[model samples]
Target: MKNKIVAALLAFFLGIFGVHKFYLGENLGGILYLLFSWTFIPGFLAFFDFLGLLLMSDQAFNAKFNPGIPYSVLDGSRSAQDITVALSQLKKLYDQDAITAEEYEEKRRKLLNEL
Candidate 1:
């Protein structure tokens, strides 16, 4: 949620620097966005990013779990380890292409239940 907010702001303001991509832990994606920003690509990409984030679920955000202050703020009422593990697994699966974006979200909600 926080990343999404930051991304929205960056997309609207400092998107050329790809601040939102960095915020999302997408360092490579951010760099790519930055490199092409001058070509007007980043701005266009930011629009899609904004839309994707808007369509993203709270559960999906929770599953990404980058940690820091936002982690506790979003769902501190739940166990941290449960969220951590879910985030880890999701990340692994994402890297492995074992699950689609839709599946990642559903599994995320299930993992949150463990918390």
Candidate 2:
């Protein structure tokens, strides 16, 4: 998973060459930055991008960059066993009135689908 901190650092340090843009999969923007690097405009723009990256929320960053699965899920390193345990935990929660039946069913469906 791409880290926000890493991306921000790239923008702050090597932004003059648009390294961060390339890391972010913005090939067109990276090319443009490379083309204008001689004018130092890319450097200034990269500074702003660095600030923006720092200010952006994790959810927004994940939605834009990671898509589908969030970084939190990837970071958990869940295997099939882990997913099974989680499903069991959800069932226990439902049985104990911690979660509603609909919530339990919905989460269970999602977990099963992942398998």
Candidate 3:
């Protein structure tokens, strides 16, 4: 669970020494930044990285750093198969009288709109 604010701060403050790169688990990049810290190029690049981190959406950050979550959930998009399965489950609940007809219709529309 890498935090966007933390990464941005690290990049801005300690990025010349590749602290942000290390936080992001890019050892090679961190090492390279350390190697060239004397030139100050890494500092300038780290500034850009800081800006980029600040501009990036939280979901994009999560997708990049957090593993194991489905891409559909992260992006808020769903495939036809997902919608189909969800609709079927909803239909089963409706048949079982677990949900009212009005509820079923509303939920069904919401699921379909994800296409």
Q: Give the number of the best model, judged by TM-score.
A: 2
Model 1 clash tally, residue pairs: 0
Kindly give the stretch of ten consecutive residues in candidate 1 with the minimal lDDT sum: 65-74
lDDT of each: 0.74, 0.89, 0.90
Worst 10 residues of 2 by lDDT: 70-79
Between candidates 1 and 3, the one scoring higher on TM-score is 3
Candidate 3's residue-wise lDDT over 1-115, tens digit each? 5778999999999999999999988889999999999999999999999999999988788878766666676557888987898899999999999999999999999998888
Cα deviation of 106 in candidate 3 (Å)? 35
1-115 in candidate 2: lDDT tens per residue? 6779999999999998999999999999999999999999999999999999999998888889888774547565566776888899998999899989999999999888777
Which residue pairs in model 1 clash with each other? Answer: none
Model 1 Cα lDDT, one tens digit per residue, 1-115: 4556666677667667788888777899889988888898888778777777777776676567354445444655547765796589798997899889898888887777766
